[model samples]
Target: MVLELHVWGPAFSLPSIDPKCLAAIAYFSQAVPKDAWVLVASSDPSVSPTNELPALKNGPTWVSQFRNIVDYLRQYSDGAWDLDSNLNALETADNTAFSSFLESRAQPLIDLSLYVSSQNYWQCTSPAYGDLLQWPNQWLLPPRIHSAAKARTAHLGLSALDLDAMEDQRKRDHSAAVAAGKIPANFIQRPRDTVSKLLGRTSHQSQFRLEALTGELFEPLEAMLGGKDYLVTADRPTSLDCLATGYLALALVPELTFPWLRDAMKSKAHSLTAYTQRMRHKCYGTAAVKVADAYPSLSPSPSPSHLPWQTPERARLATVGYTLINSLADNTPILSSIRAQNRLRQAVESSKADLSDVEREALAKHATGMKKDVLVSVAAAVGGVVALLGYMVQTGFFSHEGEEEYEEEEEEYEEEPLEIEVGEAPDAFGVMGL
Candidate 1:
């Protein structure tokens, strides 16, 4: 059977495509007994005018993965891949048990994707995924990662990759190459060096970097699946593994081109890079899924005892959280505007006269107790300007109206005594009291 796999997203490029993911597709395509075709379809509104899939260069396959437009296509296709659409269908079918089970497995993954999508709309919908996790006795988040951390010492390899030396060397080489009018030592080295320098200089500081926080999030999944071959066959690759492996390869790049992260995980060990490359190929090509002989043993101890216990998953989660917070601090340009609006709203609301006496006293006490806390939290989020602004807004400090109210008395100007109207007292200040 000829198989065609399509990627429905923003754009298409082999390098942009995760090699592992492509490898998995390639593997599956080759594994099929008869000739099979592979294709990519980009649903990005701004698709390049010149894009042409080699496989589909011949003709259309009548197969597609339309994301938001799932319903229209579902009428014709036997199966649709989107989890949201599938869950919606299941809900309609009213197969409560099956729907609940699928939801339990899929919603967390969806929530994680939304969190990492870095778009505002994603966050708006992330909470909805909570409905899938609901149960009478179950907690919102599974304790799988927590328990694994208490039991396992394995690190999720949260250490950032240091490629500064490579970057420094590449820069030096480029400067030399430019001076010498040569191709920069080696032909392949130029692009490799360029990528290294570019990635190394950029910091990983974005909401989407949460995708790399896989260790913690994958704990329940790993526990449920155990250590098993993830593809269709021991020797053949699967689309799911391709996605996973592809994402991992991108996340684990040695150079840190992504700004939301400090760096990537690096090692002098040949086997480590080799393993990554192998995984990449297997997921992206025709290579079969095979367990590496030298997978790292679980660590005996965790890093940073004060943070959290050392489960591979916990470490992963911590690393992701750190990257996200760091990104918010360093990269979020709109944060200041949002914060200013929030502060302004708070000031105006607090000036209202609806407070009960008890509430007012409690608020005062809370304000007193929170002096240090406020300084730290607000300062961190909005900087020293917050304190000044808060004071001015809260107490009417620095306000023009308040300052004008205290204008110097007329005594300073030797105000001329007003001539009273005929038969009227000197205190009469208006033309007519009537």
Candidate 2:
């Protein structure tokens, strides 16, 4: 019987961006026969019984949660690896407790880093989903996902710091740092510099919050992981390893939203990083390389291809229009300087004879007129793009008719499960407790 794992497209060299999906991938990577299992990178949530990715279709059985999938594989599959098979009842209870603890404690940080942190969400996390979706969805889904993530973070009280307050605090800190000669006064101001430094700062409340959470969760994991191959002192990989590897893999990535989290993971939970790397190597092996190339569609699609316009001709027109708008939106002084230089060069080249003062004045006037004409042309192009987009929207060119048909087909496949076993899904951040 074939096993199919439905998961989000791979990103950041992991099986999926969602830690739960990564955990499921890690667990089943060891359990199922390579030929028997198949991975489907899909964005549609309607196919799953629970409307989530990382759901598994094991022959006739459908399991949605990671733990439920693990249980199903263990019960029915031959040669399925079970790390807790030999553990005593006491150790089993400890493993279960630790797994729950780790999930509850670490999930929020992951959420904060990937979604709440603007740097990671915009630059890294959101773009990761681009290729998995088509037009409008490729453009539309990310903001929705970002909004949902922000809402979740706000609900968790991590986003309680008011934006204006944070900005004011950051400015004060930056000013202080410059005065103290800690940061060069002339250092190039990057968009990420302030946020990065703020998150990295030891004294910042956000940093302290992150560190406290890191210590609470990772310190115990580090203690348990001392000289052990796996989190649970098991000779083989277990469910805990799957969960640990997921968060650890994400935390260890240098491009994570919170660099402090990466720094903390490396400095405070160094052992876990090593453990994660080892687990990755042992389970994935050459599959990682294959994943990178074979799953090109898993990466973000090229920007030009996913425009919402109906025809290639219209998309091309829109691209030109947008380019003109971008050029017009540049700093006025910079654009003025550029225009002045170009006018000077053209005036010099166009002069076939020594010009009188009046000729020079006339040339200057013509150049000024040319600049106005250029601006008018740019404005017209922008207006054209807007009008084109409005027409497309009115005509329903962006409507995804095929998606409705696809969903209809999916509805037929949504059958009553041969076996139903639900387990508490691992929360990225477990409930706060020791």
Q: Pick the candidate with the highest TM-score.
A: 2
- Candidate 1 Cα errors over 4 Å, as ranges: 1-15, 18-34, 38-61, 66-213, 218-227, 231-237, 258-276, 285-434
| Candidate with maximal lDDT | 2
The TM-scores of all predictions, comma-separated, are 0.26, 0.58
Per-residue lDDT over 1-434 for candidate 1, one digit per residue giving the tens place of the 0 to 100 score: 33333332111112222232233333333333223333332211112222212111123333222111232223433343222232345333432332233334333333222222222112322232232222310232223222322233223221122233444666887878867987645545434333224334553432224334433334332442344443222333333343444343443431322323212223222333344456555433323221110011234432221111111112245544543463354335455444444444453346433468787677666555545454566568776678779887999765687556456544467678899777745655464564
What overall lDDT goes with each candidate model? 0.35, 0.66
Over the stretch 1-434, how does candidate 2's per-residue lDDT look in tens digits?
66778766567766567787778777767666566676766554445655567788766666777777777677775434565677778878878998888788888777777777766666777677775554534654576667766666675555422233466666888889999999999876545344655545533676567668789878999999888888776577778888888777777753654465787888887778788888876654534432233244434652221101111112245544543453454335546545664646565555333578787778777767767766777788789999999999999889997999899999988887699789988775665542
Q: State the TM-score for model 1.
A: 0.26
**Model 2 residue 172 lDDT?**
86
The clash count for each model shown is 28, 8
Q: In model 2, what are the clashing residue pairs, if there are any?
A: 103-429, 103-430, 104-429, 104-430, 104-431, 105-430, 107-428, 107-429
